[model samples]
Target: MADDSLFAQGMATRRAVLGDAHVDNATARTTEFDADFQTFITEGAWGSVWSRPGLSKRERSLVTLALLAGLGHEEEFAMHVRATLNTGATPADIKEALLHVAVYAGVPAANSAFKIAKQELAKRQEAAQ
Candidate 1:
């Protein structure tokens, strides 16, 4: 079925972008109530949008960071910040995106995003040590 194939593709892309461990943990936590929501995000966000060819994963990652920060999606912004390693989005890239978020979204949103980003990036640095 088309939906099945799309879900498969979405899973692959999601794993690629978010990494297996992250995807596995999310899959493990899925419940009946949120199962459909998970599938929808996988199929719609990962398969349909992320899988598109016009933008590289890095570009997509930066854009996603900015949007999440702009909209004050703290948890998701943090998750995506962690995902930057797999997405090839450098810290510099994140800084630039957050700057854009400040101008377009608001200083308060960007300020919160910057704080979260700093914490995430610091955690990454500590992990590498």
Candidate 2:
């Protein structure tokens, strides 16, 4: 773990944002081939980007949602939708983000994201109940 403060911070942030169960599942599923990929995201995405103080976690959450939507990353988008609870992004915020996605990224991406978001939201609601 030399020269790996970012990785450590990223790992902690990832766990907090994604939850212990989700992080554990990801770790458990990591194979030799993809281990490096996971490490890079952990350090770069979680540590360097997410840990930055420039943007609040809530704001980052919304931006991430839009980007994921725009890029058609359905599974990742849904997982992030679930992360909103920890990041403090409300449903209204997500709705508004998707609106931006529709305008800038186009209707199709936002449309599909909305469907995925709805399903994930429903699942969260059900789990809460």
Best prediction by lDDT: 1
lDDT on C-alpha atoms for all candidate structures:
0.95, 0.93
lDDT of 2 by residue, 1-71 (tens): 32389889999999888888999999999998998898899999999999999999899999999999999
Residues 1-129, model 1: lDDT tens digits: 239988999999999999999999999999989999999999999999999999999999999999999999999999999999998999999999999999999999999999999999999999999
TM-score for every candidate vs. truth?
0.97, 0.95
**Per-residue lDDT value at 28 in model 1:** 99
